[model samples]
Target chain A: MSKALLYDATLCIDCKQCEAACADQNKLPYDDNIAKEERQSEHKFTAVLSKNDKYMRRLCMNCQEPACVSVCPVAALRKTSEGPVIYEANRCMGCRYCMAACPFGVPKYEWSSLNPKVRKCTMCPDRVLAGRQTACAENCPTGATKFGDRDELINEARKRIQDNPANYIHHIYGVEEVGGTSVLLLSGVPFEEFGYRTDFPRDPLPLRTYQVLSKIPDFIPLGFVTLGGIWWITHRREAVAAAEGRQAHQAGKELK
Target chain B: MKIKFTFWKAVFLLIVAAGAYGTFVRFFRGLGASTNLSDQFPWGIWIGFDVLCGVMLAAGGFTLTAAVHILNIQRLKPIVRPTILTAFLGYVLVSVALLFDLGRPYNIWHPLIMRNPHSVMFEVAYCVMLYTTVLALEFSPIVLERFNLQKPLKVVKAVLIPLVLLGVILSTLHQSSLGTLYLIMPTKLHPFWYTPLLPVFFFLSAIAVGLAMTIFESSMSSKHFGRELELPILQELGRVLLVVLTVYAILRFEDLLHRGVFHQLLVAGYERNLFLLEIVLALVLPLTLLAIPKIRQSAGGLYLAAVSVVLGFITNRLNVSITGMETAAGLHYVPKWTEIAITGAIIAVGFALFALAVNYLPIFPEHREAAGPEAPVAAKAAVLSHAGD
Candidate 1:
């Protein structure tokens, strides 16, 4: 029942209807110049980035094991069981560690606010929960952004590549990148040429952090015991030295 | 009522005025308008210099406490009080700097009530909070003594050993955790500063810089406060600095080699040049200078070497936080004049507080009475050793 979006770049005509729809749905100011936004921002969660006469959507990849979710100190950003990654403004302390941790650099901060929050594309989790497509997919004029069950959409993407081997690239962009994102991207050109981060490892980024954090318990005990032992031995020597000196002084008094 | 118009005081007042103005703009206009920070470059010198370098410099508290209280290094006992004060003030400054840097400055306390064990920043926040409290407790005896609170002094004395041990433990965790903050940033962080053993590198360098900072503080205090320099102890500290620096340099190069990025050093590039400068100036130059017996013994030579180490370490932190991530950030980030002004003001305030504490409290450990003009330095050392016991 988990939903996903299949974004076929070949069908996208840079119309930016999705961007307009997203802005309207999210209550952002309408912008006709959506293509001018080369990157996503706090106000512009979704943008159409153009390169060499082709367009690609720049939004949250919505990974299964999101790095932003993992690194958020207050659980302000969460990946729901339903599918999309969502952010809670009230819960955020504005640490912005999520902004740094995300591989795709999806999370944008409201830096100018007296009270700022991390902003990103939520993939319309509320709409999906109501059994409807995301605003972007619902409004795509060319049927480029098709929303459905993740497994089915992924299979459909593979079938398109298989049927049109000469027209499409062999690889599905998000099938295994960063432990598989919920959003699948298909392109005529290679994913990298369209500005996808193809260099990310297959494993989730948090796995590396876990590898280091798992060793903390070992450090605490080892550091305490080692430091404690040094403290005891050093102070014990001083205490004993002082005691022996006291006894020697008593012996001198008795001799006198 | 006219104020004295000394040059330094004028400079201090100007910094405070500029800083207050910057802080006003920062709070009113917000981080976007005030700072050069963006989505691309979320972190800047405030995090690097104020938080990272400030925390490292304050490491003298735990290192000196462990040496004097745990290791029974009697010669270091005299300077323990002053070093703890410096550390306490340093941590306080870091906390304040964080307040300015955080986007929602009011929610800085969310980490206290909200728990997120998975995040390294969670660990850092908890450690910094706990260690600052420990430092305050460790420093309380001095405050109590000044107030003639004999009963409270006795109470604090009972738990002094445990406090020192806890301080060491807390300091070790957070100092390393600061490095762990960047572990998730493997891609963004340049390979030169990025390593699996970054935490270890941070811990080791903190120890080295801790010792150097102690010497740096002691030398300055000796000149201004007219206290004895404790040349023998400072010389011994120099030797330790030399050894720590050597070990740190060896480990760093070994890490680079293991990662198969040794060729990164050979590349004629900006990152490579910065990496070389950091290693050579901070590690190599000071290491070489401190190894010489003459340089270790002479006050001026020791001061120069310690300053080199301090500057070198600061450069290393800046490079890690700023220069390392430059390419990935895409846009160049030159910190706003407001950012520099605020940082300068924080340092100025820290120094002013330290001076106030020194003038009022007994930071120099009854030095003039024990280390009299007639007493030879060796004899004075013996007196202080007995006093420590």
Candidate 2:
């Protein structure tokens, strides 16, 4: 039931409609200068990059189990059941652990503002919840950037590769990357050629930190008991020695 | 009370003034304007040096308290007060520096209520808060004695053993948790520094640096205050440092070997060179200097060994936090001058406050009392009387 976005690189005709629509949907300033930039920033939620006569769109991967959400001390970021990882600005203390933890480097900070907030793709949660397509999906001239149920998109991507094996790559980029992101991609060329990280672990990144954090409950009690035991033994030994010395002094006084 | 405008004091004042301006720019203009930190390089020396190294260097507070209070090594009691003060000051400075680094400095208290049990950072935050409180309590008896508040002093004294135990436990948790912060960055962190045993490495290195810092502080204070150097105790600390450095070196290399990253040591690269430098400074130099009995027994030699260990500790932390991530980040992050100024200012404030505290408080035992072998007995009697009261 979770919604997902499937981006077909071969179908994208360098139209740049998705970029315009995303900027519009997010209420970010979109000008010629901002539009021409090939990077996602606080001012630009999504961007389209052109290389070797092929186009690819870049935005937040919105992982099923987000590293950002796991690392955030304040729980400002959370993964919604509907497939989008959302952030609450009011809850964020701006620790930027999210910025460091994100494997995709998707989160951008409003570093220029006195009161800054981490900015990234929200995946149009409102539109997805209302049963409407995202702005980028609605504005795409071709069916390049399609929004639909994640499982159906996976099926649709598999069919596209099966139908035209010669035209598309055999692999789906997001099907297993960082434990399967909501955003899926189909590329004619290798995903890495489009500057995508293909080296991500198939397992979720949050599990790595969880493995360490889970041991704390066991550690606290063990450490406390050991320290307490040592303090008791040492204090008892001191008291015993002090008592023996006092008895010897009393015996010496009686002998005199 | 007249302040002397000595050469170094004047320089310190200048740095603080520059730091004040940097702080203004940071608050008004934001991190982007003041630092070179970008999305690719989210953390700089603020987190690396000011927070990481600051906390590490302050490990002496727990280590010494544990030694004296828990282990019953009462010979170390004379030096415990100053070490606690340094730790209290160090933690306070770290909090101050974090305010400058955080994007939303005002919302620092959010972690207190908004719980994220899964986050290592959350663990670190809670431990730092709790440990700072424990350190304040551990240090309160000195303040109480200075003000001649007998009733409160007795209350604090009665709880001293439990308080010291709590301090050690808190230090152990956070010191290791700091390493856990980087456990999530396995792909990004260089293999030379990354391992599952990172928390263990962090904890062990913290203990070693804790001892080294005690010696370094003792040496510096002896010279500054025109007091006799506590050579015997410092020499004993050096011997302990030798044992710790040896174990640390063995485990570090063993971990590298176990991970099949031993070959990285032979590679001619920036990371390898930095790794070698860290080992040489942190392990080899201190071990060599402290192993020789004559050198270990000498005040100057012991001081040099401690300084080397301290420097090596700093190098290791910086390498782990900054240098290790450079290739993956795709750029070398050189901290802006404003960032350096702020860090410098924080250190200067620590020194200024320490000097003021030493002048006002009974941080060190009286020369005659410290010189006597009866000092420990006197201290025990004082504690017994407080308990009886």
Candidate 3:
């Protein structure tokens, strides 16, 4: 039973209760270090993005094989025994390769710190272990972000979509995007129109990354063999020239 | 015409002071305080210039060695050792830049010992570490020879062939791996720059830029060092540059066409403008200039083409890692004054390191060496006797 969360932006009223509750639950600071000029956007795991008469709940989608986890050079970020993709800032070297690798572009760096750690929604792993609900699910007044087993959540969302065709878009965001995400989304508008990435292929994220890495095997040998042939030719010339010079020197010395 | 570089020393000190202050501000304030980086622009000039351009410039070691030791083109020998030294310095600079980028630099070793085989970055970390070692091994002969240690130098020389090939293989893998590092961020990396062929493009451009930088670095070294310019050697290099650029241009256009981003080239904006500039200056101009047999033979003209290609490589890196990447929502990064300082600091360190190596070590070739220079008979006498015994 894979754990998942369903975030329906349609139900989000932009109340920011989820954000407030997350901060309160996690004991996160307002980050005074981020100066007024530096604070371009609000900081938190779950953010409500509003533009063009639409609102979006931005949080970790927890893809089947999370890119952040796969791309982390250190095992600082890992998938938990349960299902959540997590990070141990203590272990992170902060190369930010994970930030570059996330297709959804979800990881946020703590650039305001002398020692910054990447920040993202961890799906309230701590609360789940303690048999409690995540802050976002518990505090959502409109029942927008619900937490439960992934299959149940998908089925429920599907039932809702089937019940109201006009009220909902036919496609479920994250069902197969980037080989399926644990976090699901229900939307009234198409996911792409709202800046959601729906065009990803079915391959695991790292395999797609290997689009370039896989060909290197061929070139390594080719590059070397080409160099080797050149080496042999040049060395052969050097050997022949050296022998000729020695023979000429011997003849001249004999005459002397 | 040897300009004694007390002038450079003065510049180095000033840069060091400014860089130190910048680091202080960054350490106290944060990454945002130092760089024009944001969630949307997480990788800025720091990565674009420091890692991408630096690595490409370092390609001289691989390309030149492939010519000399591997292909046995002994004419290319004068360029080889110096280029390797330059590349070693470039990689060291890249490592330094990565340290600055790390959120928790202290914890960097955790990944090294942790051994996460499943991760791409895990492979990258190991590769960087191993390649750095290979580079050091490849460079140790200069230090030994400078000390006039024939025994150690003999031992090092014996391993040279194997080591050079290893370097080529490692460089090829990592040079391309650097591109694969971006594979996980397909949606984040712009479609125009982000193609399935990114690794191939990176490998091809690296080969060209490697040759270009070698040509560029060699000409500069000759102009400054009072070493007789190896005009004939570089004439052949100019030919290589033309071929590389021709291929890169064709492949680039093919990439755009394959991805259907050729239309993106006509989008009537800054991205398009930058793309046009990249085509004209970095690829087309260099290709056109070097294509002419007479122009390619001229020392000055060939050098300029190399620089243009280097500049072109830098622009491409910036476009892929920063300018074109649109990650992070409602957040745009501007390099803090500290970011500039830190970047300057890394460069300053690179310059300082080069100064130290060139002065103390035998990075530059002696004039007689490239005129078919060989090891002094006296120095080889004892080792030759030992071999006979």
Candidate 4:
């Protein structure tokens, strides 16, 4: 079963226990400053922002068709079947194309390191593979962040919304945006109020690039034939002109 | 050859020295210390100017080779060597700048072995690597002749046509692929610059800038090296420039109108103003100057128009890479002094190397004919020796 995390903004208490659990699980250093930070960074893979008297958790969306995965020149970023977008640090050339490509802007670079690596939420790939819950979900005090099968979670989210329509917005954020993400969100207010991009296309972002890239194979042969034909005709014309000039010179010499 | 310790040379050396220090700092302390780049703006001038503008500016190589070798416009032959040399050096410097910009410069070759054809970046990487090699091969004849290596020269000459064809193909792929790099970022990029026709826009502008660079280089060489200007050829090029600029302008506005982003131009803001400035510098200025036969005929006027095109090309690329994304990024980005220093050093090295190459090699045609009645038999012989193969 493909795993997923459902984050309910109304239920989050902003106690930051999930943040602490994420830092601990990832073995990243955390402190007062990191706790106060509302933005995800190389050190902070996840953050909980306070907006409109509600706490919203920010992390990698782990898209079904990840833009970062597609744009990585060296296959450094990959979308695992376990519903996580993982990074192979060894494979990364540090081109940062992934950083630029991520619509959510989730990937953060360790720019201060001489040998830098892109840092982002892995959704606890190891634990998920071991049939265990992610640290954030495991440590959530209020069941605000729940991890389970993606399909079941979507059903649960729909049930909650259908059961109480007035308490929740009509839209489910990650269901269709950028062709669906592993992480789903339920918010009482509009997602745009919390600085989420509400304008993302319904289709996967990589499709846009592939639309142009797919034509390159056809373009290559056509380019060669056109260029080669031009070369042949022009060179042949030059050769014929040179040959006639020689013949003309020979005839003139005979007359003399 | 003796070196001159002129004031300009001193300045060049200082900038290079500063750049070397910046490089050292960049490698040791990492990109965070050397640049103002952040998570929001992962790319800066190094990618925009050094890599993007650098590659586009070097388009002169494929353009001239196509004209002279494929199209049989032998009149442009005199400037081909210098143009190739500029391109070779431009690509080499772009690679050098990539070292400064890439977080792991040592692993730059990963793209070669770890192939991802789906990525536009992957295609760009392959094209740049392959085209740089092609440029090197295209440029080797000059070096071979200087050393009097007959055997290898014959072999290279025999394959020159195929090599030129390959360069054009590769140039076309990557020059437009640079624009394709932004296609995936439709949400991030502003609509004014974002269109499905980005690749076409990029390809067209590269050609225009390529011609402009040729004219610019010719004028610079004539003024500095005390060589006679190739006025008739440049005048002819100016007319071509006019046509290309007109087409590019028409297509660009048409794209904007078609995308229904033409109204964005009416909105008073930084992006709109910058767009206007880019159009004026890149399109309007050059088009107006080149359309006038009197200005096109004059060397000074032609130089001014070419410079405008070059500057405007720089602006356009920068706008696409930086300004277009700034509003979406929700923050302003400015390159650090170290970033500026390194960029300056790279350009300075290009100038220094070009001067050295010109001083040492047979970059210009030996015979002097300023569009004189007499046929340039010697110059034609030099070019035909390669073309005949």
The model with the greatest DockQ is 4
Question: 2 or 4, which is superior by DockQ?
Answer: 4
Ranking by TM-score: 4, 2, 1, 3
> All predictions: root-mean-square deviation over Cα?
5.4, 6.0, 7.4, 5.5
Candidate 4's fnat? 0.84
Predictions' DockQ, in order? 0.71, 0.81, 0.53, 0.84
Better of 2 and 3 by lDDT: 2
Candidate 4 local lDDT, A14-117, one digit each (tens): 99998999999999999888999999999999999997688889999999999999999999888889898999998888889888889998999998999999
Q: Per-residue alpha-carbon lDDT of model 4 for B1-389, expressed as tens digits?
A: 23445555556668878999998889999999999999999999999999999999999999999999999899999999999999999999999999889888899999979988999999999999999999999999888887779999999999999999999999999999999999988888888788989998899999999999999989877766667999998987888889889999999988888889977777899999988889999998988898888998999999999999998989999999999989988999889999999998888778767766775667888622122324322332222222111
- On DockQ, the stronger of 3 and 4 is 4
Which stretches of model 2 miss by more than 4 angstroms?
A244-256, B367-389
Q: What is the lDDT of residue A23 in candidate 1?
A: 88
Query: In model 4, which regions exceed 4 Å deviation?
Result: A245-256, B1-4, B367-389
Q: How would you encode candidate 3's per-residue C-alpha lDDT over B219-279 as one tens digit per residue? A: 7656544557888888888887788778878888887887888877667865677677777
Rank all candidate structures by their DockQ, best first, as comma-separated numbers: 4, 2, 1, 3
Candidate 1 wrongly placed segments (more than 4 Å): A242-256, B1-3, B367-389
Clashing residue pairs, candidate 4? none
lDDT of each: 0.84, 0.88, 0.74, 0.89
lDDT per residue as tens, model 1, A120-143: 899998898888999999999999
Kindly list the per-residue Cα lDDT of model 3 for residues A60-132, writing each as its tens digit. 8778888778777778888775557888877888778777777776788877878787888887889876667
Mind giving the per-residue lDDT tens digits that candidate 2 earns over B331-357? 999999999999988887787777667
Off by over 4 Å in 3: A9-17, A29-43, A48-56, A129-133, A189-203, A211-256, B1-9, B326-334, B367-389
